[model samples]
Structure formats: structure tokens, C-alpha cells
Target: MKNKSLYLYSFNQRKGIFLLLLVMIFTQAIYFFWSSNTTPQKDKENHQWLALQSHVDSLKQVKEEFKPTIYPFNPNFISDVKGYRLGMSVEELDRLFAFRKQNKYVNSAKEFQSVTGVSDSLLAVISPYFKFPDWVNQPQKEYVKFENKISDVKPKTKIDINLATQEDLIKVYGIGPALSERILKQREVLGGFASMEQLAFVWGLNPDVIENVNKSFAVVSTSGIKKIKINDLSIKELSKFPYFNYTIAKEIVTYRSMKGDIQNIEDLTKINGFPVEKLKFIALYLEF
Candidate 1:
């Protein structure tokens, strides 16, 4: 009787274990089937997301391709007939020629509305690209037609730097009474700039204004100053000497660094852009 009872218990335990195993296997099969099948709705969402991403990428590429080109159109002006050079970069020639009167030209892209002939649609197109150079000012100044007052007769020998008064300085374009006083003050302070760059150091001289006027002034320094430092001179300052511009001055400074200190006047020949003739003129006043 005891052995039969033990055998019955063992048989029941085996049946219970087998039933649990069968249930686990059935649950795992259902999970695997569901995971393997993708729903149409989910597939559609993925496809749409990929298409949207591709379209965005294409638009980005198009913007990048045209980023370098300049386009000018005042967005306000719909009438295209009156607008000339509607889609062009501002050239120096354009700046000079576009002026009908002094200070009348549309400078800022936003200022296109002020132009007399610009239509609303044309201004709308040009507003984005039509920025004014720093020199252009608004509330237009009257165009003083250049009077060739001193054409044939040379003026009473160039104004003497040592003795020139405030009135003397205002005769030159771009130099005002205040700036003229400042120039004299700087000369007194630094014992003269030892170079033209000193004018740039004046309290209120605008760099662009200096550049424009520098070409007209000739250096008559009889004081025998020599060897102006190229690296220390400002563009307007360096430009006062004959045949020197910002570009040439920059090249000289660069060459001085690359080749080490300029050894002698002849050493300038090794630098690009410094022609022999130019070097001869420059050698008179330049030092290492």
C-alpha cells in the first residue's frame, strides 16, 4: 500500500510540470508571431518620415548651391521695368554711376523705398541685397559740383605743416576743422607720427575718409624723417607716400614676417608686388 501511494504522487508531479512547460511554449509562440509581422500603418509612417527627411535635405542643398551668388531685388517693387541692375552685386562703378545727385542713391536694402523711381515690387526684391557702403550717408548732402578753382595756377606753395592754422586744413576734402586741429595736436603730442599713419591716430578722422583724401595730399616733410615702419603704419597713413595702397602695404608687412627682418632697401625686391621702381621710391623713407 505504501509503494502504490508514492508512485501515484510522482505521476501527478510529472503531469503538472509538463502542463506548465506547454503553457510557456504557447505564450512564446504568440509573441514571436506578432513581432515578426509589421502593420501597414507603421510601415506608412516610416515611409512618410523618410520622404520628409529627403525633401528637407534637398532644399538645404539648393540653398547651399546659391549661397555664393549675389542677388539684388527690392522686395517692395513688383514693377520690374523701372529697376535696372535688379539682380547684380554692387560694383564700385555702380556706386559711382548710380548717383543722380549727391546722397540721393538708395544705400541700405531697407532704404530702397526712398529712391524716387523704385517701384514697390522692385524694392521688395532688392531689399535683401542692397546694403550701403559705410561712406554713404542719408538726408542727402548737396552735390557741390567740383569747381576747378586752382586748375592752372599752382597754389602758394603747399600749406606749411609747421605753420598751418585751422582754416588752412579745411581746404582739403575729407579733412574738417576739428580733424585739422587734431592733426596738429597729434604732431605736437608724438613729435609728429614719424609716419603718415599719425593722421589715422587723430581723434576723429574716419579711416575711409582718410583714404579718400590721402591721394590728394603730397608729403612735403622737409624735416628729414626717415625709415617709416611698414608694420606700424595704418592703410591711410602708409598710403600718403607715393604709389602705396592698402594691398601693397599688407604685402610688405607679410613679406617682412616670412623672410625675417628686412635687411636692406634692396631686400624689398624679393617680396612680390614690390617692383624695382616702386622699391626705389619706397626705400627713401622705409626702414626694416
Candidate 2:
């Protein structure tokens, strides 16, 4: 009985306590060993990541040792890698890409800057190497220079595009009854043409046809225009605009409702999908 109890604990009870302690210590030692091995792997990964980050940082800090030879390039066709090589950042490249996707050409360095918003210093460095199509650079300059003598001049009065009849429009090279009708329809919808440039947007009129129309007719007068008041315009009412589609009308209404009245070209330009390029011409046809 004395052996069974040593300070209120029996022999079996002491053995059970000793075994429990040994098990606890054994599990602790095993866990320590496992963690020590796994910790080194985690540390190795962390060290590798830091080393790679350091390498990237060093690369960023270093400047180009030599400038690459820049051949004459059409600024219109600049690719991502080409833009990067030309010192254009991603944002500038993206803007230019968006412009080109609309089938518009950048005719001059000034236009390029307007579209891309590139830095002037960078533009100066790159503009010298820009080569454009002959038509853009000159309209047969050599031919015109060779023959200095002027041809027989016939003074033809330019007709106003807004008031031109179907017969008058048909006199242009490519405008037939169908095209003339379409132009008149467009004029009726928009109240009047703001400029001769609006002829380019007429359906079925190509560049050559537009040029012909411009030579024959012009937007001589802008008076009596049926301009839409856009500040309180409903989506349907705004959608009736020649340029604004249903989607754009909805967005405009949404923008107006949320942000307040669209006061001017600057406010319209801030809209998510408004075409900022044609804002000047667009502003002419809209009533404040």
C-alpha cells in the first residue's frame, strides 16, 4: 500500500504521468525538427525573391549605354516594342493606338502630339525621323513646281452645302441621286452642315468624292441651325443627334444626372466615351 502511493499518487498513476510527459517532449522535438527543415525552404524562397527584386531594381536604375540607330519610320504604324524603343511610355502608346484604330491618320508631328500627348522633348528627338506618305507631305510638289504657268482659271461660285439641291449635289463627281438624298437626309436630321468637312461623314462618299464636294460646295452659313439643348436632354432626344447613338446618349444622360450639366467642350471631353477629337466641330452644332 505504501509503495502504491507516493505523496497521494499510485504506482500506475506515476507511470501514466511519466509517459504523458515523454510523449509531449517527443512531439515537441519532432515538431522543432520539421519546422527547422521547412523554415530553411521558406527562407530560401524569400531570399530568391529579394535577389530577383534587387536585380530588377538595378536594371531600372541603369541608363542605356548607347542609342540604337533609328531609321525613318511612319509614326502612324508604331508598334508596342517600337514605341518603347522610341522612348514612348505605355500611356502615350495606348492613346496613339486608340486613335489609329479609328482609321484616322496622324498627318504631322503636331497632330501626333495632340493624339498621343507625348512630351515635347521626346517628340523633338523623334520627329526628325518621321516619314509620311507623299500625299500627306506634298500634293505632287515636283509636278507643280515644274509647271509654274497657271492654267486657264474659271471662277465658279461655291454653293452652300446646307442649301444645295439634289441637282446641285449630283453635279459633284461621285454624288448621284442616292448619295444626294442621303446627304439631304443627314442635313435634315442635323438641321444644317457646320462645315464642308461634314461631307466626309456622309454615307457612300469616299475621300475623292468628299474632296470633289468640298471644291464645289461649302457651309457658307450657320444661321438658323436647329441646335439641341443638351443640358436637360433625355436619352431619346440626345439619341436623335447625328453623332450620338443610343449608348452614347444614355451615357451622356447618366453623366449629366450624376455630375451636373455638361457646360462646354471640356465637360463633354471628360465623359467616359465621348470623342474628344471632333469636339470643336461637334460643339458648333450643339446649343449650350
Candidate 3:
């Protein structure tokens, strides 16, 4: 009986140990299954992160698309900083500045490139944004209207180039605001236009444009001219004239001081660099 009791106890202990192991494995499996299914909070956080990532990516795309907008601007007045931003090199900017320092302007894309020495590639990129003065793009009137009781035929009125305003000049084909301003500036410097041929001297005025200007305008009166008293004027005063540069002015003053007084326009021919060809034009602005 004692031996049988001992055997039963040993068998019970082994069975208990096996049951304990089975229970432990079942609990571990339950924990693993529960952990595998994500919590609502974790799931929500993951969704939020994905949404944030997508939004950031969209913002990056928009930023790329909206970057650096270029606008229409005048290339003539481009500063060093502006030129640099436009891909112009230091040498190119210096060339442009040098041209401008002489009171010259770049009126066209070709002239701009010629002055700046920029590459064709850069010119192609920036030329489209070059906004010239407004008058250049304006369409001129092809015909003039007349109100006459007797005849229906309307004759085009001739404008005086010397008296014409910027608006008036733009009415002529090929004369834009910039060229019109240039014409006025040239006329101011010379005192007045003495002849229709003087139109050829206007900067950036092409042959065809000059032809159109000639057709539309005339020098009707010499009364508006401002003449200089050559004999009494100082070298500085003489140099102020468009025709007489500093060197020529100094020579004329020197000649006057030595020769007493200038008798006539013919006497100026004796001076060096007198611009003999332009004597007639220069004569209009000088007095004895």
C-alpha cells in the first residue's frame, strides 16, 4: 500500500509540471496575439505622421514651382547687383558701364549685347524680359484727317522736328519714346535742328526711321534757336556746346586769345579738329 501511494504522488507531480508548462505557453501566445493588433492611439499617430509627410512633400513641390519670378525691366539702367543676378559677368557689366559713362545708351538687344559682350545664350534668356521705353512699341497713325468744306482730300500735316513733343514724334512710324527723347536731348544740346538732315545724327535712329522722320517733320523756323557768342564765351562755355568738345573748345579759346576775336565761321576752319563738315550746322548755334 505504501509503495503504491509513493508511485501515485510521483505521477501527479509530473502531470502538474506538464499542465504548468502548457498554461505558461498559452498565456505567452495570448500576450503575443494581443500585442500584434495595434492600439487605436498608435494607429492614429501613424496616420498623422503619414499625412504630415505627404503635406510636407506637396509644400516642397509648390516651393520649387513658385521660385524666383523674373519681371520686365530696362536693361539700360541695370545696376551691378541686377546685372549679376541676370548672369552678367563683371567684365560685361564694366563694358556696359563704360558705354553708359560716355552718355550713350543701348537702344536695342543687338546693341545691348555689343556693349555688354554677353554670350548669345544669356542674351536669349534675358532679352525677352528687356522692357524698353513705351514709345518704341506704340503704333503710329498711318493717315491724317482733315475737315474741309470744299475738298474731301486730307493732306498730312508736317510736324516741326524741333518743336515736336515726345507725343508728336511717336506719331511718326519707327519713332518710339526713347528715340523721341534722344532726338529732343540732341536738339537741346545743339540748341536747335538747323536742317532736316540733322535727323541722321540722332542716336539709334536707323536709316529707315530717319526717312520716316524726314517725311513727317521739317525745320520751319530758326527763331527758337539759342546761339552762343563765340568771341566772349570762355573755354568752359564753348566746351558745353555739343559740337565743341573740351579739346576743340580749348583750341578755339586759345586762337581767340591770340587772334583778338573770331571774325566769322570761316575762321574756325583754321583751328584743328573744327569738324569742318559740321561747320554749317555749328554755325547756326554761334554768333560773332
Candidate 4:
């Protein structure tokens, strides 16, 4: 009878135990539902972050593509892409290539134009940025300055050869009193010198003396000399001219007798050993 009473007493708390069990079951259900959602929520956040990151990267790439920047570069060393960027055509690039193949470089903007034949408008746009090496620019600058200064400087006073006095002629280093008189006599015989080159024909005036004469004297006033007809002159008469020797005069007379007339200096080139080099010089005093 005591054991039955104890069992009945234990059964009296069964409602409270069932309610506590229900509470535990509800907490476990809540915990499991939270756990199931946590990973997918984190994954969703990660996917959004990745999409944002990709969009930012694409924006950066577009910015980089559109950005315009140019740096000074040597035209001599330009590659195809660089040249294209500078607006050079294929033919212009090819010209630069061919010029470079000869181991030559474009030293100046002008030289670059001459080599590549770049249009003036395009050259105007790109030329300011063309950075040649220091050596390239320096020498050209110095030479140009030298030429400009030379041109800018006043010419020293000079006396015309035809009008120069004997005292003036003697001022040249090699010309003595006798040489000065000889030059004056020759000037008188010729009426006046047409060119300083005629000084070479002055008897006993060697090349050294001629060089000295050129320093102080110049044929500034061109005086016309009488031109002789090649057809009319005998070999003897032609040989008497300062330029023509006996053999050359004979050859000329023979060529004229056979060929009718030497139309120009070109016609004289056909004669054997006609001093073909001096044809132009000789042509100065000859009429056909």
C-alpha cells in the first residue's frame, strides 16, 4: 500500500515536466532554424560584395582606357605604336625606317620633315614634344648660330679687282712690285676680269699667289669680255688664247671642220682628249 501511494505522488508532477519538455523542444526548434539561415545569409552578403567589387574594377578599367597622357619621346626611337599615337601614316613611318636603316638620325624638326615627309599640320601638333638627344640639338644649334652670326657680321671693306691700285695689289703676301705690275697689265689687256677665276690665267701667278690675291681682291664688278666664234678661228689664232694649248686648238679646229659646228659644250665632249673638264670654263669665252 505505501509503494502505490509513492507512485501516485510521482505522477502528480507529470504536467509541469511535460510543459518544461515542450519549452526545451521550442528552444531547440528556434536554434536549428537560426543555424540553417546563418550560412546562406553570409553567402548572400559575399555575393553582393563580389558584384560590387567587380563593378568597381570595371569602372577603374574604363577610366584607365579613356585617360589621355603623353610624354616627350625621341622621334628617332619611335616604335609603330608610338608613331601611330603621334598620328604618323604608314608611308611616313616607312620613310623613317628606311632613313634609320642608313644609320642616320633626324636631327631637327626640319630634318624630320625632310625624312618622313610629315604634313605641316601634323608636324606642328607633334613637333613640340619631339625630344632629340642633347648632341643632336646642340651641334645643329651651334652650326646655325655660327652661320647666322657669319651672315649678320659686316663684310670687311674690299676693293674691286679691276679698279684696285698697284699699292693695293702689293698688300697681298706673295705679290711683289713686279707681280702687281703684271696683274695690272693683264687686267688692262682683258679690259677687266669677269671673274676671279681668270686670275689663274695670269702668267707666273702660281696657285699659292692666286690664293693670296683672293683674300684682298674680288671681281665684284663683272666686265664683259669679247666672245670669239669657234668656227671662224684658225688653230694658230685659237692656240693664242690663254686657255687653249696648240694640241687642243688643233683638235677643236679639226672637230669643227668635220662636225660643222659645236652647238654647245656637250658637242666638244665627243672629241678625243678635248679637255672635257674645262669645257664649261672654255665655253665662257666661246660663242657656239
Best by TM-score: 3
If both were scored by TM-score, which would come out higher, candidate 2 or candidate 4?
Answer: 2
lDDT per residue for candidate 3 within 124-172, as digits (tens), equals 9999999876545565557778657777766788987778899989877
Model 4: how far residue 2 lies from native, Å: 99
- In the predicted model 2, the residue pairs found to clash are none
Give the winner by TM-score: 2 or 3: 3
What are the per-residue Cα lDDT tens digits for candidate 2 across 137-157? Answer: 644323344653768866688
Residue 31 of model 3, lDDT score: 88
Query: What lDDT tens digits, residue by residue, belong to model 1 across residues 175-283?
Result: 6666777777755643333445445546556676677445545455636444577656665676665456677767776776687767787677776787565454446
* Candidate 4: residue 80 Cα off by (Å): 76
Candidate lDDT values, in order:
0.59, 0.85, 0.85, 0.80
lDDT of 2: 0.85
lDDT of 4 by residue, 127-224 (tens): 98889754345432222334454557877777899899999997776677777898888777656776788777676576766886887788777555
TM-score of each: 0.28, 0.47, 0.51, 0.42
Local lDDT at 229 for model 4: 87
Instruction: Give the C-alpha miss distance for residue 40 in model 1, angstroms.
Output: 49
Q: Scored by Cα lDDT, where does model 4 land?
A: 0.80
Q: Give the TM-score of candidate 3.
A: 0.51
> Where's the lowest-lDDT run of ten residues in candidate 3?
133-142
Segments in model 2 whose C-alpha atoms lie over 4 Å from true places: 1-154
